[model samples]
Target: MLAGKVSLKTVRSFVLHVFVLAFSCLMIYPVLWMLSSSLKEGNEIFVNAHKLIPSVWTFSNYAEGFKGYSGQSFMVFLKNSFIVTISSVLGTVLSCTVVAYGFARISFKGAAFFFGCMMMTMMLPAEVLTIPQYIFFHKIGWVNTFAPLIIPSFFGTAFFIFLVVQFLRGLPAELDESARVDGCGHGGILFRILLPLLVPVLITVSIFKFYWTWDDFFSPLLYLTKPEMATVALALKNMSDNTFGTSWGMVFAMSIVSLAPVFLIFIALQKYIVEGISTTGMKG
Candidate 1:
């Protein structure tokens, strides 16, 4: 009976492994196709769309895509994207941490009410605020610049604030008391005691900020007009000229390039991301 049960368990494990492997291949096939297409000639892309490996591999798509449009190279767009992404990440981490710490640790008049309002903002759809934000930014002369992309991040975001708040709540209040006894004020307690412990969540916040800002297309499209000021997302869109003909190979090449940083960052910090999400009271 024991031997029979062992054999059944082994068979079940083998089946599960096969199922998971098949599902992973299904998920990865599109990316593989895109990578393959990026190396193929424009005409051959559609004709050989089903093929995973190209018959004639070429690097000209990457060359042409990097050559860029108008007066700027793809490097210029990448630089603009890096500037916006880095600045936004810094601003988000700073603002969100402070705001979340306040909500989590400090108590004052109307604090609960204010926190409730902030939570409500998360429930509100971003599309609902688009018109109002555009009007406001336009009135302030921020419509045509990176200011529109970078400035609002300084005010803190609902999701990041919430994440940090949850993480902060999990931390023991005794740390704050101990810090106070050591002549540390609230700022000192935050900076000296809590911040070090909050590294995982901060990394999570940074990862979120990095990817969102890097991948943002709609805001850049809505605000930026000059080709020189375009981000990678906007530049990729500009690369596709349907008026003449879309360069499918170049588009695919640039898309692959655009995805590189996000993939690298995620791979490098995946452990921290998993730890942060798992331990930060998100499971409930």
Candidate 2:
């Protein structure tokens, strides 16, 4: 009877594993299709749409895709994306950390009121600000420039500020008090004491900002009129030309290229993202 019971348990466990594996494969099927299609000859892509393996794999798609829609290279779009993404990440880290430090550690007149306003901004949809922001940027001659894309990041992003604030609140206030006893001013306390401990949260913020900014198509579409100024996302969209037949193989190849950085970053730093978010406010 004990042997039979053990056998039954093993069978149930095996069935569960099989079910999970099947579901995971189903979810990843489209990505697999795209990856496979990217390696296929253009004429063979749709012909064997159901097939996972290409009849004849060709690397010409990647080459063709790298040769951009206009005279520009894919590297130009890639460079533009990196400049904007890196700058915005730096700006977000600087602005959000300072704002969060103030909200979590410092007390001043109207602090609560200001914090409330900041929190309210998180509830506001980005779509609502699009038109007015465009007009404002246009009036200031910032439109059609990287200024529209990169400048706003110097101001604190509400979500990252809130994230850092939560993390800071989890830290003991005694750290600041102890730093003060060492003749450290607020700047010294923040820079010398807390900044080191903030690595995980800062990394989390950078990863989130990187992913959002890199994948962003609409913002670049709205601001970048020149082909030379296009980001990877915008360049990919522009590749689909109705005048000339859209190159599916090239599009798929570039799409895969575009996903590479985001995937690599997430794979490498996903643990920190989980750690930062999970530990936030837990101590407090």
Candidate 3:
């Protein structure tokens, strides 16, 4: 009976492993297809969509994709993306941490009411505010600039604030009292006592902001007009020509290139991201 049970368990484990492997391949196939298609000749991409490996491998797609529009190389788009992404990440981390600290530590009138209002904002669809935001930015003459992309991040976002607030609530309040006893003001309490403990959540926030800002296509498209100011997302979109034939290979190549930063950032900081999320909301 013991040997029969062992054999059954082994068979179940084998079946589970095979199922997981098949599911992983199914999920990864599209990315593999895109990578393969990027190396393929333009005409061969559609014809050979079923194949994971290209018969005619060439680096010309990457070369042609880098030969960007209006005398600018793809490097310019990448630079624009990096500038916006980095600035936005910094602004988000700074503003969200400050706002979250206030919510988590400070006791003041209507603090609960204000926190509730902030949380309510997260429930509303971002699309609902787009027109209003556009009108407001236009009135301030901030349209067509990186200001539109990076400025709002400084004001504080509800999601990041909530994440940080949850993490902060989990920390021991005794730390704050001890810091105060040691002659630390509110600023010192925050910067000296709490900030070090907040590193994981801050990294999580930075990673989230980095990916969001980098992958953002619609906002850049809506605000930026000049070809020179275009981000990688916009530049990639522009790579497709309807009047002329679209360069599928180049588009795929640049798409793959655009994914590199996101992949690298996630791989590097995934540990902190997982830890931050798993720990959030676990404490009062």
Task: Report the candidate with higher TM-score, 2 versus 3.
Answer: 2
- Output the worst ten-in-a-row residue range by lDDT, candidate 1: 275-284
Q: Quote the positional error of residue 148 for candidate 2 in Å.
A: 1.0
lDDT of 2 at 199: 86
Local accuracy by lDDT, each model: 0.90, 0.89, 0.89
Highest TM-score scorer: 2
The local lDDT score (0 to 100) that residue 73 gets in candidate 2 is 95
Identify the superior model by TM-score, candidate 1 or candidate 2. Answer: 2
Compared with the true structure, what per-residue lDDT tens digits does model 1 show for residues 9-54? 7889889999999999999999999999999988899995799888
State how far residue 105 of model 1 sits from its true place (Å).
1.6
Worst lDDT 10-window in candidate 2:
275-284
For 230-249, candidate 3 gives per-residue lDDT tens digits of 99999988877564367889
TM-score of 3: 0.92
- Prediction RMSDs, each to the true structure: 3.1, 3.1, 3.3
TM-score of each: 0.92, 0.94, 0.92
The whole-model C-alpha lDDT of candidate 2 against the native structure comes to: 0.89
lDDT over C-alpha atoms for residue 262 of model 1: 82
